[model samples]
Target chain A: MKQRHYKYIVPILLGTLFSCQKSSNNEDFNQIVEANPIETEVDVSSEIAMQVIEQMPSPLEISAIIKKTGLSYNSGILNPITHMENYTTNSQKAINFGIYATDLGYVNMYNSSQDAMNYLETVSSLSQDLNVSHFFNFELLQKLATNEQNLDSLMHISTQNFEEINDYLAKSQRGDLGALIIAGGWIEGMYLACEVHQKSDHKSLREKIGDQKVSLSSLISLMNAYKSNPDVELINKDLMKLQNIFNKIQVKEHTRESKVIEEDGIPMYQDKKVLTVMVTDDEINQIRTLVIDLRNRLVK
Target chain B: MTLKRLFISCFMLNSFIMSSECNLEEFSKNAAQKLAGYTYLKTYKLDASKEAEIEYSYVFSNNTQYVLTLAHELETTDILVSIYDNNRKELCNNYDKKGKKYFQGIGYSCSATGIYYVMFSFKNAKNKCGASVLGFKK
Candidate 1:
């Protein structure tokens, strides 16, 4: 009787242990990420990719530009949960992770507690799906979101978590995911910028929108690193099209000829070094339409 | 009975591995607060592996006032932070070249939108384990 029971217990125990080991590996994101076997010539080293990733502006910084325009808070722009169903690929999940997090940044800046909580949940969920939940302090973020007084703390913590996530992903084997995250945040920021321009028609905001051309170049470099991945390729392709439009927009610099000059026994740093973004209303409209169209499809 | 022992052992190993990841949020948050009135933007870590000097880059926005500061484990540090533009032009350094002094932080208001580099170096100080924070005000 003991010998016969041995076979049953041994097999069942081994199966349970195997399942535990699988989940403990934390490769859930790999399943959807490696969906495509297609190969391409484009490749970039982690060091190069990380440089681009770090060089890009923080998600909060991008959101800050939008807030600086004094644009009214519009919850309707938040990526609806219905579109989340389309996130069947790792790149999609990573991009939406950035998109939702950008929305969170925008809301926190506006002090929208209800919207902040909702976005916190979404960001947390996507982090888990991307197998990077270990970096986020969801519990602490939840506490901070509950009180308006903790808004700054909430912003800093939330930004810190995502920043760490991006840093790690850029250096890790999933460098593509990191690039996609940056790409997603940028697209959402652009979408919001376009939306804000439509309502407020803020001049500084328009210059900032034109200034995105600089960031767009960096974002493309990051995406090109992972162009071999079909999902990343799709994103890079969309950005390349946007790049065509951006190519026409010229941002001329009005920098002081001298960096520092001695005046009356004192050195003075140049005070009026600014870029004069020469973006016409027609070009702005084109950027708005293309950004919205791409943003809508990705959100869905 | 042996199966039960194997299960427990696996569980313990898994728990240990999962708990090993470090959290640097507190350190970064504290470092960012030193920016004083400027909102936090980003953080850069300088590890022991970086020899003598390390460089990092950021694409700063136009017409934005930014500050960079470093905090280390030591009570005092000689880590000098410098800011530069894409052309390798040194915009400013925390070190007072004329006064022969080194400061832990520097501030620069970007007048143009493009890539900017920051370099950190120790002045005869061996410890390189520290982090720097970047904060901005529009």
Candidate 2:
């Protein structure tokens, strides 16, 4: 009886020791990320894809252009800040975050601090939900939102944060979400431009809308990389519809004259190609309608 | 159980790993200061290779004023920024016609609506990591 009891106790002790050893090994493996990480084979295509995505212009530029037109703030055109709860999925949250960010930039351009706060709150909540809030400086943003006089600082900080967030997401292997954020922002921007065009006749603004044809094509090609994602595929389908309208807008390019000019005693090289957008009012109307429909689908 | 303890310990250690190695935040903040009065547009990290030229393809709306600035860890290396048109023709490099190659930035008044490429590389030594920022004015 004594020998049998000893045998049972020994086996039990051995089992617990082995379990502890295995756990320790697992912990060590996890800690390797902090140590000198082993460099994995670089995926050139994926790297190129991220580079292209990051290369896309910030929507704030478009919003600033819109502001330059002296248009009044149309809160109805923006996605409601209260719709924070509506974005339940990761994809929806990411896309709406982009929409709200563009809206925030627009509001900042107009010096609408009160409206900016609401949009900022919605954006912060979404960022937190997506676990990318670390990249955003909420405190600084809040301070800027309250102080409308510092509009330039607000714009700079907001744009920089978004780029950082995109970088972090791409580095973390979430490039698909980064692509969606860009797609969402670009669509919202084009929608805003088209809406403004619908209301007023600004030739530059119209040209800006037509010029987005190039951006839209680039965005679609980027989306194609992540077409395996159902969410991305659906967005591509909607954009393709918009693309069909964009295809009708013709852009004629002229030969670039390369020259160097002296400005302020500094030699400035000029090698610019002039492109004329030949888009009619009817096509503009089509773009406006389709953009509104697509934006509605996204925000809804 | 020991497994539970191990999981917890691993998570704690993983947090340390996530703290960041390059401190891009501090670098970006410093870069933002250089772009004063101009609304920031985008920031990029410079690859640590002199021979590795990275081209960023973007669209500059017609008649827009834009500027691009490059920042680097001065103790380690320097960066060169350049811009090109859709036809891949060199528009301007930070190195001016007066033989100034150390300038870390360039400004372009975009007069056309088309794709533009902003390329970056190191100047002296290779593998000099840095950051670049873009801003625009109306």
Candidate 3:
């Protein structure tokens, strides 16, 4: 027994020593790994997925159009900053983050500093809850909001901050939360359009509202991608009801020629297409009702 | 020296190589610089090959103005950007009135509300790498 134990110990010690010396040096380790390139399958699906989500319209565009329509800031139509506390779950917080972001955009476009500051606070809170506070510069944004003259810079900063937040979420494998934020923003934008259109008749704004059918489809597709998540399933079900209504709306597309013209020695090209929305007053009313119901479910 | 340590180093090196391949972070930073002051909506990476076109479908609302900016290594690459309506009709391409193809950006004032596609590709690009940023003003 003693002889056998000694024989085993000698070989074990020799093996350990050889192994340590083999990879002990940094240069040798590097060379060994270099000689045999490690196979790593790069997955950029997260980046691509985020890119697709970003393609969805920014609620800011809708808010900007509403502003251009010569409409005053109807504070009543927006989600109140007070509702910020009701969002307890990650899903709720994510969606409300989107909702507050749209509200902030509307207020900013109208140069309503007080409302902007309020919504900014709510946005900061939601972002913090989601652990994305690092992307949001609350102090800087507050100072920018205080000075109305810096609206452009403020918009730029806010947009970049959101982009960073979404990117970080995607990288961290929390893309589902990012999607909820976008869906929330889209729903709020739709709600605003429905609300404003119900109040006034602006042909351009009507067309813009009707055009949301396409975006709604995109949003549904996005949500459907994560239908397995219970939170996502609930949102998907609600959006599908809107999708069913949108299916009835017809969009007539006409081909048009695009031409490039020279302006100040630069080539300027203006491409326009003719799309006629065939939706009756009844159809829009149905949409408006559903939008209110959906948004209420989110806010309440 | 241990098997576990060797495996860990290999994994680390693999991640390093993967990131170093395209360096998307660097590309995004460069693109972000060009899109400064503009509210960035999205960024798309264009492959270096002229034939490698990337198309994105977006809902371009009416009565709003959109600006699409392209960023690339100035000395190494050139990219062409274009927009088309839902009807597959070309709205705008980064081409001069003289039909010259050298251009970097296109601005579209959308008067019609519908879905549109923004397409990007390299134009006689030597490096075959770059990105484009989208911004809109209402």
Candidate 4:
């Protein structure tokens, strides 16, 4: 009887051990699945499609332009005369000159060629031609242009100029005009950041800009208060439209890669993809509604 | 007696397995939600030796593609941006080396809508980058 009991006890112990091992394995599997999970795909709708089409800069027109003239690098070129007029009438020409002169320095740094440097020098001279003051001086421009062959010097000069400008902006109160100029400077800084990122993968423009993170929406709201008072309706309208666009494009997920995995008998997905272009119908309609609202407000 | 013990053990094991599976699914959903809601910005110190930085403001409307002013100009380090919905569903993740504009979709079936948090950071900076958020209410 004792021998029989011992045999039964051994089998029972072995069974318990097996059960514990199996459960532990199951838990491990579950943990893996949790770490690597899958996301459900959203269904894109037709209304969203229509809205997207409406907002797109007629692809046909873009394609036609491309087909007709290949690619035109002059799309972003500002009409110098008109731009200058806007610069002066909207506010002080000196500030505008200073801003553009600084921009030229950045443009020159990236190009780092005799021709590019010459072009920037011309731009710098043009700013002086407008009789813009030293308060808005292109000291940074001179430094960048003279040190065309040195990337480190160029970066240091640009950074210093930006610091000075930021200090000026902080101390001076020029209403909306100053804000607009700063906003433009931000874009120029972004341009330089992008150049830096491209030349070296060790730094990213986004990261640089990220450090100076400002709420674009909030800035627009502040500008909106001055809208009717200044009657800069057209500019206000454009800015509002821009604000809407910014809203649509800013999404979480910093990178553009995604992955999917499976654990045990279950499958899961891990999304690492950054900057996906696919937009759902709901997203499109939302943007359309916002645009229409901005247009209506501007028209009123 | 043996049959009774086997039955009890089977029941307990089934319950434990079921609970473990459910817990994992819940965790994934939570993670997705966190990713969707995350947002941050960064700014870098301007190199004074170069030109004064240009100021720019950007807005994305109706699938419009606006070029990042730095494209072809500045050397960029790390760039990462992702889009997600209110429910935490991952929409898009885009990394740009050339400072290219990432086009937001306008009207499309299955396009995502709503407020998206665009979180971004640079490799070597301690500051945050600022970005404007714009969208229409559905």
Ordered from best to worst lDDT, the candidate numbers read: 1, 2, 3, 4
What DockQ, between 0 and 1, does each candidate earn? 0.23, 0.23, 0.22, 0.02
Give every candidate's TM-score on chain A.
0.80, 0.80, 0.81, 0.40
DockQ of 2: 0.23
Model 4, range B9-77, lDDT digits (tens) per residue?
Answer: 999999877543323223322322222211111122222122222121222222222211111111322
Better of 3 and 4 by TM-score: 3
Ranking by TM-score: 1, 2, 3, 4
Query: In lDDT terms, which candidate is top?
Result: 1
Q: Chain B, TM-score, each prediction? A: 0.73, 0.74, 0.73, 0.28
| Candidate 3 Cα outliers beyond 4 Å, as residue runs | A1-48, A255-257, A263-266, B1-40, B43-55, B73-76, B84-92, B97-101, B111-115, B124-131
Docking class of 4: incorrect
- Best TM-score among the predictions, by candidate number: 1
Q: Which ten residues in a row have the lowest lDDT in candidate 2 chain A?
A: A1-10
lDDT by residue (A117-140, candidate 2, tens digit) is 888888888999989998788999
CAPRI class of candidate 1 = acceptable
Give the per-residue lDDT digits (tens) of candidate 4, residues A1-300: 000000001113424431111121112222322222221111112222111111211112111222223222231321133354443344344334334544444343344444335544544454345432243345655555565465334433343343344334333443344344443433333333333333342222223222222233433433342233243334456556645545555444354344433222112223333333333345444443543443233212
lDDT of 2 by residue, B1-138 (tens): 899999999998887655424555566667666775567887766554433566676777777767676666665566667787766667778775457445656777776766787877776743356677777777
Please give the distance, in angstroms, between residue A30's alpha carbon in candidate 3 and its true position after superposition: 46
TM-score-better candidate, 2 vs 3: 2
**lDDT score for residue B54 of model 1:** 76
Interface RMSD of 4: 18.1
